[model samples]
Target: MFSTYLFFFLSTVALISAVMVLLSKKPIHGVLYLTLTFFTLAGHYILLNAQFLAVVHIIVYAGAIMVLFLFTVMLLNLNIEGEFQKSTLMKFVAAIAGGMLFLVLIGTLKSFDVATVGNPELTQIGLVKNLGKTLYSEYLMPFELSSILFLSAMVGAVMLGKTTKK
Candidate 1:
């Protein structure tokens, strides 16, 4: 009962923050709203008993990514006078697109089996131990491949960062 209420509260905050991220005129405000949205998503992960995911979400999105976004926004030097105003036609088109997306989401929700109950035995699925076991066992190949991909990306970044002689 309490969980349900908490979930709804968190969800409401997330939705509001997400909307604020888009609606905010100032870039810094938008970044702050986006950070709030990320925090609320972390709250949702906590409510789902996925502590690992919650921690990672906060660390990656709210912490590192939000900092990067803030830096980018600040470096862009977006002045109020230099801001671009949206035309009436663009606003109307955006509203129509938003409505269509809402309708699609509602249709998807209706197709889901809301009455289905989760398996109580699988409660530990979100824990670090189980996650490690699954990754090392069931998803070993994909995990290793992703690690290799990251290594290659790091190498490429280092190569690009190096200053070559003229």
Candidate 2:
């Protein structure tokens, strides 16, 4: 009963923050809303017994990524006066596209079979030790590849920054 209420509360906050992120006039406010959304998602992860995921989400997204977004917004000095308003036609098209995507997502989720999704006795799958073992044994290559991809992205960002220095 308590968990149900908690879930609803967190989900509502998450949804509201996500909408605020999009609707916020200032870039910093949008970033703050995005951070709130991430925190709520981490709360969901905690409720789902994914402690590792919740911690990582808080650390990586709410901590590091949000700081990066805040810094970027500050550096760019984006303000209402410097920004151009979107045309009504463009806004209408974007709304239509967003609605279509939301409908597609709902349809796909409705077709999904939750019963056959995972092993019935795999409750310990979210534990850090089990996750580490699985990552090292079965998903090692993909994990290493992701690290390499991040490294390349960092290098690209540095190169871009260097070019802009002049």
In model 1, how large is the Cα lDDT of residue 146?
95
Per-residue lDDT of model 2, residues 93-149, tens digit only: 999999999999999999986676654234677778888899899999999999999
lDDT of each: 0.84, 0.86
Worst 10 residues of 2 by lDDT: 113-122
Residue 127 of model 1: what lDDT?
Answer: 84
TM-score, structure 1 vs. true: 0.83
Best by TM-score: 2
List the RMSD of every prediction in angstroms: 2.9, 2.8
Deviating ranges (above 4 Å) for candidate 2 = 111-113, 116-122, 164-166
